[model samples]
Target chain A: MIDNIEIIGLIAGILTTSAFVPQVYKTWKSKSAESLSLTMYLVFFVGIVLWLIYGISINSLAMIFANAVTGFLALLLIFFKLRFK
Target chain B: MIDNIEIIGLIAGILTTSAFVPQVYKTWKSKSAESLSLTMYLVFFVGIVLWLIYGISINSLAMIFANAVTGFLALLLIFFKLRFK
Candidate 1:
């Protein structure tokens, strides 16, 4: 059975993972990414990929799911940053 | 002794945590946040705090350190998003 700490971690993962959606949606809708930092997204994407690898190495389902989605979303933001520029 | 998986997690945490630095620097230097989504930062800050709590609960030094720094950085972004707008 999952403990309270695990539940907290799960919620935290969900929040952090889904947090990128708004930025993506806003950028897509506005068709502007001027103020968005390309460096930040690039670094963030690489970091997310590393996190995904770490997740897989440990076989943690939450980490795997969170990093996978977050990484994809970060990629979209990166694309938006470039395309909208 | 730290294992390989733990080392990987540490690297991942460092990457993800420090990823926000460029963003904060860019936003502060530009004095503009037009393309930055306030909603995203707001949600992200809350999520980082939750992650910090989760990290503490799990007794993971990496998580605690990463989330604490990331949370502060996220907060700075949020402040920049508001102040620059």
Candidate 2:
């Protein structure tokens, strides 16, 4: 049961991480983020950055990993939005 | 110092949860998810679901709240996608 739950957690992490891929690809391909929300991304980037710090403070590897990657992706979007806008 | 970090964490939580809102609004208003990837949403939905479960297991209010809202938003997008597609 424990192992099963761990597997589920792992799956969850993988899914969320990969889910951003399409948006990443779309932004990368079009060099446009007009459809994306700049305000939201900026706020979210800050939030994820905090989460990363929290994860680090708490020594939570999973949170650290997930938020770090998500933050990176969010940052990429921010970059494109600024560059293309 | 600790209080400040808590504030930061709270802001982070809020940002991530709210980040899904614009996408939700856009999807709702457009009645289209042509730019959104179904596969990514489905996977992210599952991941958030697991995160919710994990939150429950750990009794983490912040995780539970954030994931629940995000999952709900994701579900709404999924519903729109299915209905419009």
Candidate 3:
């Protein structure tokens, strides 16, 4: 069974992972990413991927799930950054 | 002593946290935030704060350091989003 601390981590993961949704939606609707930093998203995507690998190494389901989803979302943002450019 | 796994985690934390620096620099120099979603930064800031608390609870130095710095950076992004509007 998961403990309270793990639960907090899970919630934190969820919040951070899902936080990208609105930005994705907004960017999609606007079809403009001028103000968005491609470098930031690129670096962030690499970081998320590293986080995913680290999560896998540690066997933390929470980290795996969060980093996986966030990595995907960050990838999409990168794509949008390029496509919208 | 830190293990390989912890080192990976530390590198991941460093990448993710420092990823925002370019964004902050870009936004600061550009002085425009039209394409930035305020909601994203707001939610991200909250998530980072939660992550910091979770880090503290778990006594993970990496998490604490990453989240603390990221939280501050995210907050600055939020402020820029508002002020540059």
- What total of clashing residue pairs does each candidate reach? 0, 0, 0
* lDDT, candidates in the order shown: 0.82, 0.76, 0.86
Best candidate, TM-score: 3
DockQ comparisons of all candidates to the true complex? 0.74, 0.54, 0.78
Q: Per-residue lDDT tens digits of candidate 2, residues A1-85?
A: 2465455555666678778888888877877676677887887788888877866665556667788888888888888889988
Ranking by DockQ: 3, 1, 2
* Error of model 2, residue A9, in angstroms: 4.2
* CA deviation > 4 Å runs, candidate 2: A1-10, B1-8
TM-scores for all candidates: the values are 0.92, 0.82, 0.95
CAPRI band for model 2? medium
| Higher-TM-score candidate of 2 and 3 | 3
Clash pairs detected, candidate 3: none
Across residues A1-85, which tens digit of lDDT does each residue of candidate 1 receive? 4678677767878889878898889999999988787888887888888878876775556667788999999989888888989
Q: Which DockQ-derived CAPRI band holds candidate 3? A: medium
Once fitted onto the true fold, the runs of candidate 3 whose alpha carbons sit more than 4 angstroms away are none
Give the C-alpha miss distance for residue A4 in model 1, angstroms.
Answer: 1.9
Candidate 1 lDDT for residue A15 = 88
Please give the range of 10 consecutive residues that has the lowest summed lDDT in model 1 chain A.
A54-63
Q: Quote the positional error of residue B75 for candidate 3 in Å.
A: 0.6
Better candidate number, 1 or 2, judged by lDDT: 1
